[model samples]
Target chain A: ATERPEALLLVMPTDHAIPDVDAFRAAVAAGVPRAVAGQIVTFGVRPDRPETGYGWIEVRGAPVDGVAQRVERFVEKPELARAEAMLAEGRYLWNAGIFLVSAKTLVAAVTAHAPDLIEPVGEAVAEARGDLDFLRLSEGPWSGVRDISIDFAVMEKAANIEVIPLGTAWSDLGDWNAVWRENGGGIVTQGAVTAIDCEGSLLRSEVGGQHVVGIGLQDLVVVAMPDAVLVADRARSQDVKTAVAQLKAKAVRQAEVFPRDHRPWGWFETLALADRFQVKRIVVKPGAALSLQSHVHRAEHWIVVSGTAQVTVGEDVKLLTENQSVYVPLGAVHRLANPGKVPVVLIEVQTGAYLGEDDIIRYEDIYARGDEQGPKR
Target chain B: ATERPEALLLVMPTDHAIPDVDAFRAAVAAGVPRAVAGQIVTFGVRPDRPETGYGWIEVRGAPVDGVAQRVERFVEKPELARAEAMLAEGRYLWNAGIFLVSAKTLVAAVTAHAPDLIEPVGEAVAEARGDLDFLRLSEGPWSGVRDISIDFAVMEKAANIEVIPLGTAWSDLGDWNAVWRENGGGIVTQGAVTAIDCEGSLLRSEVGGQHVVGIGLQDLVVVAMPDAVLVADRARSQDVKTAVAQLKAKAVRQAEVFPRDHRPWGWFETLALADRFQVKRIVVKPGAALSLQSHVHRAEHWIVVSGTAQVTVGEDVKLLTENQSVYVPLGAVHRLANPGKVPVVLIEVQTGAYLGEDDIIRYEDIYARGDEQGPKR
Candidate 1:
């Protein structure tokens, strides 16, 4: 279906940031000839510190082809003493999780080492369906495939795996500490953050009109979101998921969902929520139409603030430009659409005794979300 | 004025908190007889620590009447070693800032020691006027009185003075550290606050519906208000005034004012502010009426959420119950009042090109604020 290359294909995680792209390209190029000769190539970074957080790759002998060394084994994350001992020796390298191999070579190695995964994955891919522009894999076959990483299934068992040394500025931003290291290891701040006498800290505010301040803080991480805030030690940044899990156990909506809801058309955010009334700021993308819907418990008033909106209420249809407004009475079927070439922004004030989002009954939906009642746009 | 006591009058700063009221009363009672016998009395507490924040009172002679000692001198706040040495001497006590003296004795002492203050203070009191329930001092003579403490103007030069020891648990609460101590010396939190692995910190959130989380924090002070937030080291809590002064220099409104505006009737807070529209939640106490006013550049929509509202729009007057609404067009005279026995709560949505609070022209007001142009109720 596409221009398939014969020499090598490189795979790298999107999270790793390599500052020297030219040096990385040279390292990948050095492994291309060896990979084309049926040797599975994995890049390894020379250990600069005794970092126990990373896995290690041990090289057995000198480079067989002057650039790639024969990998002896891939070791799991080790203790401090073990990592220090490996760092004292010159043969250990941090596993960079980068692979360079031909398509045929990967298929052959998976067939030999992880024979159970290839058939189900291939069947799922062959039966994948296209939705708009995204390809969704078949659920049944994909769920049947074993969940395992390439290191556990292929690289650990393959006999001809080679290691290429990568000597460039790189970092895997796995936690707030790593992010601080990537950002020069002093004080990193963003968005309405004020710091005084702070050292080695990260303070971030993602809320629109809120502020975060830190004073005399050392080795701390403070993150402020709109609905929730997080403060943790730099060493405990990996335990942020525990806080999220705690919130989930309490059924806190802010744990997983943001105040702003993004959809295919555009986005909408709640401005205020009251007992019997609610306010929202909604933006509709150009040529996007909401579903024809009716609510038995609520009535809505929409005021256009930006582009024009095509509004249909009951039997009447009208175009509302900036500064114009329309009202939908309870039990009235209505549809809102943006027919212009720009986004339409409006403020919606809904009033009712029961104003939950599940009160809506959709008759037609363009984004195929009529049956799914999780959130309303 | 009706029941003047012949015994001593006790004066203490309102900010100081003494936990053992019984012991304090007993100490005051001990000084009453001495004070009635024509000696001015001052209380002193034995130093529990080498506290440099308070002035020291040095005693010279033993108890004259078995409970009070003759006073010697008052020393300014001392350096560390001086305070420690004074503590070790056992003759110096921390000034408790309490004074007790008979009215006639105080008059005689002031006449002899601070002759200049007696005349103007007497004239100001003689010419004071009664306004409603308050006695207002005459401005001219009151302003002429010198700004000097009683210790400097009278007590230092008085011949018959006595010092009494009073042992009790007390706190000045001069700064956040003192407040922390008053709260029992560990993490003290109020409102919606969550803490993890925090020690000796104070985290407070005064705003409703806002969460303040502190993790791995030690000796930190964090205060969150609706419109502003403050974070500072516990050691530098006394320097928080500098931050407020800096904000004042920048003309930040949050430095001196809160988001909620308190009125004589009740209070109101802004819910949302936009380019040409603003929303406010207003509460009115029973039997409270707003001014008859009109806006030049805005219109308002009032929706009653609780109780009843007596609304006057232009020439029409009506009583709106819960869930009822009314609209006031621009330049239309209007007034809102709570006529029921219960409080009234309403949401006001104002739409205009210029939505400043100063756009109102008041014709009549029951609160006698027609001539004053300030925040409107």
Candidate 2:
């Protein structure tokens, strides 16, 4: 917390911002001592354009030695000429998503300007809970506050906000173009990508997925996420939020999320699709068991491909190994357990007229999934 | 072939010389009556430019009754201004790939001027060997013949080389740009592409093999092949032959061909890589088996993920079902057979200090891979 006559690093993080860990570390190592002199240290990013996409900072007057003059005022992205002027004069920064401060000075400064943030943040820190190396802020206070960025509530009103021009490469990774810029362009392919005439774009496919191909495209973003695919122009990538909003508005099952949700127990994914039938690849961790339940509308066929599967079907219990299979009729009380010490992988083919999450009638659940179950998270 | 009115077709391939198929077809279709009565038929193409890329025909004298013209002389693509003057004069026609003529008239003209081609072509056809669906021409006398296009070898020398300009949309498909134009400019990825200052461009990506992402590029042709990738300027695409020659010179595996070699059985692909180890996903068709072989430097591990695998390790044999595994030590002869009526899918992990195709020693074979040891086509 002590300033050591090094530079003060200012980091401002936007919501959903994931700052480059390496750059933040580099900035800290470069500016620790200069911060002791009460000189300002802030990171300045080159504006991507006269971007209505970001908040703009205008540095007024000349530099006081190495420290920049006080910021005149914060302004949102301006008209075209002003943006061009900003690019020409080159003093303004794009308000990089991060900032670092001299512990003593920033606390003093924030207390003077925005007392509400400082007190709650201080209390939260004092009473902060730690679990698994993560600092969990008390949700009651952290989420209760008005949704406002530090730029709006604090930085704009500060008087001695000096600028540190970031000539080093930086990217917000706010969208696909940023991702493309991060990845050196040309021949960008993930999972067997075939592309032609694509420029300044990111084409990605997740693991265990089909190959993706892009042809004669330039400056576009193609993402193959589980359950949903996203194809958008790089310039219009910010509108993905609108896509997500539309998905929510439409109540689309695919857009809501992937059907095979990942958990600590291992994940399950569906492979076969039909109106009356579905097949799933089921994997369970060692000694894990599924809930004791039955599908009201569906019957299931289980093929034990590997490991040992202990099945309780109605009045009978049996252990199945590789090359063995079983069938569970609808409404029959059934539970699958991996009684062995090895991961169990199996295929379950389900037949039903209606296959939806709501059809699952859980009788008892060890993983806390039913109504009587506790919140698992 | 019978004579038909008002429907003349010509198939003029873009090559040095051959009798046009459409011309022959048109000749057959037009019969002797209509052609002699002056209902002329012909094929015409628009010139790209004063392109040395094609052969140009010039018409002299005036149009005779708006039906026929005296083809004074055939001038190949000339200097730019002269070609422009030819176009301006509006009395020239770029030879359409096809020419239509009445059978009687064409046979008579060929007999008068190109009698040599007629005899050999006639013998070649009479003695043509039947191979599958195609008529294979024997090389004996056919190869001895002079290589000349029917247009130059016959039409130019004929007394009645009528010119009827049929302005149907046509393309030679002689270049990448022409193919792209025919398929639509944005055929690869459509309007998803945005070119900024790029010109004279041809970009194409094969599905599931390559994806091109471009930035700050111009006049470039980028083709994504299955195994190898190509990036060349449009002007230099013609020089791709040079690149292929270099690759052949260097004996690079990808330069000459692709990695996915088709076979009688199912295919195999590399899945994992390490300096001393390489893993492959091998799929065997039902009733298919690998050759009995041994590797001096490499050992292999096979884990059956699907279907039944019949494994022969030295003198012993075993049937391994899904989720079962096996290990083959170095210098130990082993062969895998898929005797079940289902495809066998397995993950094979191989480890060796030096792993190359040349390391395998085959003893007994099933698919004739060891016979004569020809290149895997």
Candidate 3:
């Protein structure tokens, strides 16, 4: 078989388990050159427990040559003692859900091992199209392909697979506890926390959450998101998916999603809200402009607290400096900008009947937000 | 034989206890007048501890036919158990080291009790002088009174003695922890604190005179003063005196003093320091001016980051606004003022052989500080 010039690197992030980025980058680079030598190099992440949530791979034989070996068998999640024994012996590597192989090599190995995965994937890539920064696979073959992981279709049965043991710092940041561990002091932990006789515990505070004071605690993680809070042991953080699903089932917005997200323009956050009123702080970057939009149900008031703001309201255009305020009635077209070389800080208060973000109708946008159906106000 | 219409209120504060003014005011209004009943009223404060570091009160009964009780005994500190018993007994109140008694009552009681304290204190107050709103007691009698508390000569000897319990918030500001608690958040706890699983533990975070990060903490009472930190139990905050004595015997500032104090006009604080450089944030209120002073060992750079400032360097006078900076060479007469209505914030960076608060040689005075015995820088 002829080897293709390009290689395919398939990566599967198993929840956020890596604790350091430098180690992960080093591990990824360690096997890159070997995979380029026509050998299938795979990183087998050893399972920390007999976790049924993740698929597993079993090593069946020794190295094929200098770079690769054949897989004897692949298993779903195994029982506890079996997993322990597999770890005791030196031959098994947990399915890392990651693969690195030349395109020709992967196709050839899968063909000899599990040919079902190749046809649809090949057909989809052959008809692939480009859209902006992403490659769009053809719908017919892409959707027709069975929803299966590479571990189940190829690595478990392939005859030329090799495992590379990686001791690296990595994390998927999949849950709140993992996020809290990595971001303890970077964000706000307000009001007061008393930690005594504890280590490796991550605690976060929200603006109006309960006054949390940890005393004689160890390795505990506490997070105060918007309306919901989480307190868990770090080792049990993987169960956060179950927690998030429960929250979704109960219709808790705070547990399912974050209230604020950064955007290219700047940032907007709702400080407080009621049925008839909503308050928001909008920070626009220097020389950035917002969309020319109008709210069907709301009247708005903009107060400038710092820097300078350029405002376009209906037919009038004005330059508002610090302490100055402006008003826009319902259905009035308006837009805001930072004309100078400094950030424009402004507070926006809206009064409306149905104060939902979807009430906004954008006439024009500078950040191409019109294409994506974003929440509006 | 005759019942006089006077008594003295003696309050003795413990180690570094800063009294809370509002709470004391509330307590006095609610408890004092009725207890006084237009007769002599005195407060007897029990000293929490004693090792000769603070003045002590010797108590005895006053002699009278119908109204006076004879003082049979007097003694200094008797040890820890004695102090604890004094606190537990219903008859004793903490010697808060403060008093509120009519002039007539104190004079008569002192004459009948110690008989020696009356003349000196009377003569001193009679010849009392005033300077810049402070009552300067005459050195002759004021200094001659042996610096004894009123408890020894007045409260203990009186036949009819009554104590209006001060249940209000009172802090003597005995140390940095007291200051931090009185000035900031309202939570306190103790033990070997590991600020995991929590937020806001006002800990004594100074380690060998270095401040450490209380991760996952907020609104904490951290008392990292000059050289030590006493991470005490918040609820058992009354025990701070024990910690202070422990630090004071070791000659550490963290237990004894704060890094900064507020003057009537403004405030100054040491922000950071190195072996060769030091930084301070100085504030001057509206119409307030710093003394015209010069340093022999260090030059200073002043940056005006907020409000407006009138800066004097040698013979030159200039107005500095936000973002403007000035330089003062060593031995140059320098003064700063807030010419505007708002407070002026100035940052001072010093570089020289020595940078201490006592390095100043004042040529002019604004707050009468030029004549006072200055600190050792």
Candidate 4:
């Protein structure tokens, strides 16, 4: 493996809220020396409540900000009574999972603890190809890597790991209750929503053209997305995972799949779908192009709404501005490209007898896709 | 006035839930003779709870099914204490406002009490013109008529007004609370919805392709429609009218206007809209046709998904079936007629520089409209 052994890596969860960036930076800077000395520094937070949801790090000394302390042991998420007893004992800190470690230390820890993951993960990383601004990881080897958290695989089992307390307001936003706490336990709202007589609630309408209204709601969470919705008690936000599991069991598309189809050329969403026709609002990123493809059953009519598009229909390629249209007959090889510096937005109407997402014939794909059909576009 | 003097009229509210149709019909049959004898019979229901939202009728005797008794007075919606007292008194019945009266008596009572409204209402009805299956009342005269409920304008002051107890369970469904009660106070839902750990709540999704999910909701009302959503405390469903008033004061179209545009041809709802393009799902009833129309700023592409449509573009006319499409050029006269024995469903995509609703030039309308702009389609 061509590892950056000397480079320091900071681990942060994506869905987290850290309000005081300066304090986090200070703690990270303070832990850099211990990381440079080949020690794994895991950040912890002083427990403000007997939170049963998080793991606890029992430190040898009191955990303090900007100073690493010796770890006694890492405790799994405890029962409520045990969490309360630990909170009262005053030696336990939340395992925030934020880590700063040198690449060599991480590699050595993983090799010593979980040697089986080394070969497949490295192969997956090495085989990944660049697609536009993102890296399309090699799926073959990646699928073989066990779905395990880094903490269990390397952190908890490794020696020379210290804990540093974060001196900042932080929340993982792991659930709706966490989000509610992050918003100061008040009625939090976003998007086109109207709340009346609601207390300690969060109402969000994340999709366009959908309005969410909450009335006489208390300690409830209502989130409206395009294809799915989540309405739950703030206290039961953790149970949403169970609901998601149930949805996945039923093979619902909205269980885990996002509403919009993301491709290397930006994204597209179906505005409307019927038995014989479908309408989509497609956005192509600046300088990005769709696959040179054609459909066997569907004919498409594309009308540009904003920016400009380089449209290919059969042997002809032309530029289409706002309000300009192009027709691609069935089986006519076509493509759409954004040549301008802004995103190209267009509406596509596909008329067909058999309209499924698998009816596409891709002659070439810039994203390195093979004959795998997409949206039958 | 040309009065059908002997006609016996039974008043049934559009919003009421009279689940037992035979019970309602039997009550009507019993009241028919009283109504024919010129005694105004107002139906009353036995109170199931101390509901303060309903008006009450103080009858001279114990109310019984299928028998008319003298009405002492009509008490307006009362406060909690008064409604509770009335519920215990056993002589009070809900003034259901379902009246049975002869046309001559109704006309005479209105002429004696609300005489100012008689001329305008009579003229409006007299001048109403037939448009399709509906009669379009003369707007000028109708607007001049005073807005008053029949109970206030005629029944409350009329002598010999009798209260007949209805032998059935019924609900006006005047508010969301009433709907919740009608649904038996459990988790009531309609359309695509999921309720988790919810009790005493109503969750509904009235629009197509919209999903509603609720969790841990109690004593709440959530209604999702195409343009507006109502979420409120089940206890304070009455305050929803205040929210509506607020929206009206702010000139929000969703406050009072419907999202669908209803015309003689059938109806159409906007599937999507943007600055330069709009998509609509239009359904035309069998044998119905749109006007010969053209838009100055937009061109339309119509793709039929169901039935058959006789489409006229400029001077060319063709019959299109499922999966067939036609392009209507800007400034070219076109019409869509459903000639088949079923509704013709089509998706219309409009491309334009300005996509306003009033951009139409109507040449001829079978529904008898003059030069007035419509979806500017």
**Cα lDDT listed for each candidate:** 0.79, 0.60, 0.58, 0.84
Model 4 residue A67 CA deviation (Å) reads 2.8
Clashes of each: 0, 35, 60, 2
Task: Give model 4's docking category.
Answer: acceptable
- The lDDT, on a scale of 0 to 1, for candidate 2 is 0.60
Model 1 in CAPRI terms: which quality?
acceptable
What is candidate 3's lDDT per residue for A143-219, written digit by digit as tens?
Answer: 88888766667666666666665565443356655466556522223333334433666655452312333433445
Query: What TM-score would each prediction reach against the true structure?
Result: 0.73, 0.49, 0.44, 0.90
Q: Give the DockQ (C-alpha) for candidate 2.
A: 0.04
TM-score of structure candidate 4: 0.90
- The residue pairs in collision within model 4 are A215-B232, A231-B215
C-alpha DockQ of every model: 0.26, 0.04, 0.02, 0.49
- Predicted structure with the largest TM-score when compared to the true one: 4
> Fraction of reference contacts reproduced per prediction?
0.25, 0.00, 0.00, 0.51
- Name the regions of candidate 1 deviating beyond 4 angstroms: A1-49, A55-76, A80-168, A249-252, A270-280, A289-305, A309-336, A346-363, A373-377, B1-174, B205-211, B250-253, B270-280, B289-337, B346-377
- For residues A1-377, what per-residue lDDT tens digits would candidate 1 score against the true structure? 12454647788987888888888988888998999898999988878899888889999853332279888988888999999999988888889889899878888889999999999998898888654445767777999999999999999999989998886767877777788778887899987677767888888877554556666777888777655566667887776667667667766566667778877678887666777777777899899888899999988877676789999999999999765677788899999999999999887777788877779889888876675546564
Off by over 4 Å in 3: A1-9, A12-42, A46-56, A62-66, A71-83, A100-198, A203-216, A222-231, A242-251, A263-267, A270-289, A296-311, A317-327, A336-355, A365-374, B1-377
Show where candidate 2 strays beyond 4 Å: A1-61, A64-69, A74-98, A102-153, A164-377, B1-175, B186-236, B246-253, B264-266, B271-274, B279-289, B303-309, B319-325, B337-347, B366-377
Scored against the native two-chain complex, candidate 3 gets a DockQ of 0.02
- Candidate 4, residues A2-51, lDDT tens digits: the string is 55688999988888888889999999999999999989999988888889
lDDT of 1 at B236: 78
